[model samples]
Target chain A: MLVIGELINGMYQNVGKAIKTKDKSIIQKLAKDQTKAGASMLDVNTGPASAQPKDAIKWLVETIQEVVDTPLALDSTKADVIEEGLKLVKGKAMINSTSADDDKLNTLIPMAKKYNAQLIGLAMDKKGIPRDRNQRSELALKIVSACMEQGFPLEDLYIDPVVLPVNVAQAQGVEVLESIREFKLLSDPSPKTVVGLSNVSQGTKNRSLINRTFLIMAVGYGLTGAIVDPLDKELMDGLITAELLLNKNIYCDSYLDAYKKK
Target chain B: MAVDLLKEKWQNKVGTITIGATKAEGGTRASTVTVGGQSTLPFMFGEGDMPNKPVIAMEIFDIIPEEWPATLKEPFKDVMNDPAKWAKKCVDEHKAELICIKLQGTHFDFGNRSDADAAAAVNAVLEAVSVPLIILGTGDEEKDNKVLAKVSEVSKGQKCLIGDATDKNYKTLAASCLADGHSIIAESPIDINIAKQVNILISDMGLPQERIAINPTIGALGYGMEYAYSIMERARLAALNGDKMLSMPFVCFVGQEAWRAKEAKGPQSEHEDWGPESTRGPLWEFMTATCMLQAGGDILIMRHPKAVEETRKYIANLMK
Candidate 1:
């Protein structure tokens, strides 16, 4: 349960507002609460939300580190913003993105390796987010190869299979699942598979409900990590329960303790 | 010795781990204890050096526990009411080399004690015992951070293990340990990939591999302990085979898990042919601990004094 807390990103309207106003309080609170809630790394994304994206990212990273010791997952589409975030991050942070796109790879992988940061490479190339299992697997391999070429350890690269909304591509969920399974078999030493868990349940009523269901399913398919909202007790609970039942967590003891606290 | 084939074949080194920080290293403990750095399997000195022997830490609670079985209750009696006394008994009577104090009361679902309360309990135990200490947070991420942050700050300069850095909350916990100069136990649900991932995540925070301990989460006998054992054995193999990121020494929480099984706690009347509660209880813990030890566990956290005593004798015999 490597919970990369998703609460600090711009995609959320409240966080976006917080970013625009230079409201350190809101960002600080999010960092504290998420760390308290068990986020290993707080994902900081100020994409298109701040007047000065680079500066805001830097401030968020610095402020969060000041209050808590948790690592930051510096997230942004712009390489420059990520570079700025990396500069401010005290320890090696994770880059939220790179893709099979040659340009994105050429720009981000070198930057990631240079900063000693782990990378989350999206399984999307110039073709954009794949709609089929074959394309998804192919893109993952391409991204992994690009990372290896840049001398990044396979362990340092986390491959996200670009989870799409189930409503639009209902069967694509199965494809994504198959792709994750296939990706694990591609190499003896393969990059870990992470999913933007919320993406699978996008545009659904009771989004947390769907997100959690999909998350459990993803974990079943060898999904090793996730970028999700740690505050979603239901989803977190589901993940904890799944880990226990799968015998991944010995003794099935932590669930009671985990649930009561949540 | 047939030219000592085992020595010739086994060349992997599991790094050594020393519990407690000495005064020269900046801690108040009377002395430090070391384990691991084995070049071969347990007690195979004919092959390679077992530089440091395995050590045991007795598990006690910050608050009096209500959910424990009556058999467990019979051992500590009133002392369980006081963590310091309980911890002292573990060190003095049980001969535990370390004490693992679990702050179960701070859980949001438990008494929900404040961070200050948990810190006071931790400090009290540290003051009472000369042995190295391991402080565990209530499993609630939010509460864990609040309490563990306080523990880390309060216990600064003492190289105690502040657990359990999970994938979700490792960064904050790892960072806290890094700043405070303490060791951490990085716990991953029983998967090699996750174990590797967490090690990487903690290391990314600039914490050295020596300062981190990995817990792959153990299972008791008849409760998937075999799976956990295999995972741990494989992890140790990977490390010895040279996976730098997965090479840290490992710890196992044998007490918390072994005592939870039905064989250990279920009514004796229900399984008359099985045996008395006293016999079955310690046996369960012993079997679980033994399984993990063979799988390369560097540290074991135990509960029953009898089990701990039995395990010590077992280790002594194996070493000889």
Candidate 2:
């Protein structure tokens, strides 16, 4: 499973303070800690809290790369903010999102190709989040067809099924899982599947439990990646154990330790 | 329909390692042997990169062996009792790339020689040969600690690959190897999990993963060699798929295990239907080495000059 470290967003208090004070140490430490915790990539998002979100994303990308070499996910709703980070990334970069909306796809798909970046396509559009499995699949088909039409490589595309909180949208939880399974069938070289994993546990007291349980279940439905807190020990352990049971990792007595070191 | 490629973009890779150090690098070896850094399974030619070829090391013991079969004993007959002469013959006449000195005399049940004697023998071989060396200890933990630690001290800057650091007795020898600037071999029974655990323990003791080679304990042909093959195959696949603990280059004691088998021993009079024992013995050793190499063995510690010659030819062809 590809772990996109989600601890460097401007919405986090420590990160927000670091961005405000221009403290590169705090950002570098977060980058090192998450990479050590098994993050295949880090998400650089200057959340809605950043007054100068464009400049903040660039600064975050530069500061993180100064310490660790893990790849970055240029995360933002704005194509221009993601583009700015793309300009500075030394390795392959990823766009945090493009929704099923035609206009957003038009702008971001070419930007993804222009920057040679992987893209995360959300299963929502300008109309809003779909409420059922069929609706989610319909939007996913739209995103896949758009990428195909633009000559974008499906292998570099990750389609997120737009996970919603189980407390408020209990029925849609099953839809998201079904959407994850259906996403793979949309193209010959199927787009990889990911989820904004924390969204599944919003407002819940059992956040870690809920997130890990759902993440493992999603993995059963062919999910290949997740944007989650790599520092959450229990969640990461559950993910490793789940992959082990799935036979993705070779069995070793100290497999958990091996997974962490890798 | 358009063809779709199935290649994997591996996130991590097996670390490359260099065994011996030269004069420029503070050691007196004429050259060093490098291994690992493979990005795919063995012989997956077009699929991934295999940066270094597997190395073959001839095993020369410190004391004359009491149980070597006649076929294996014949090649080293004259130098059987002399460690330095045996090592020199292996490199000079046998075309050996590396020499492994097995200090069996240090075992409590064996000669139980003093550490000073072991160190003296090691220094003699170092002076006699310019090729790289792998200094192995007796299986006895306490005796090996004393003998190998002394060997490490004497060969301080030689950068020889030294050890058989097990789950139980890794500290003394691993520390000595680290301080003396040598790569150490981490051994495990025919189990992948234990193999990985041994490496993790070694790494925790401050041995960098790159300086360690793995010995997934050898099992001879028809004597559970398949189990060793399977374990090695899994370890290699895991390493290619980015598992760090099982990522070290594998080393096997092929000659030790092959010679111990009855099929590779016993005269024709004892087993007439098994064909001529002389050719059969070396053939058995060669077959075992070939299979293990296919399953990702990067270094083979072998006996039998004929078998080593055949295996070297095989490795040259396979690498090409």
Which structure among the candidates has the greatest TM-score? 2
* DockQ, computed on Cα atoms, for candidate 2: 0.73
Worst 10 residues of 1 chain B by lDDT: B4-13
List candidate 2 segments past 4 Å from native. B1-12
Cα-based TM-score, every candidate? 0.55, 0.96
Q: Write one digit per residue (lDDT tens) for candidate 1, span A109-225.
A: 999889999899898877567878998888888888787777888877888888889888888889888887988876658788888888888888878888999889888888888
Question: What is the C-alpha lDDT profile of model 1 across B1-320, one tens digit per residue?
Answer: 46835343453677666778878989989888777787766566776777777888999998888888888878898799899999998888888899999999999777899999998999999989988999999778988988899999999988898899987898778888988888899998888777877777787689887888989998999998999988887777656654556667889999999999989987688888888988889889999998888888889999988899989888887777
TM-score of every candidate's chain A:
0.94, 0.98
If you assessed candidate 2 against the hidden native complex, which CAPRI class would it receive? Answer: medium
Clashing pairs in 1: A3-B168, A36-B141, A36-B142, A38-B168, A39-B168, A40-B168, A40-B169, A70-B171, A70-B172
Error of 2 at B286 (Å): 1.2
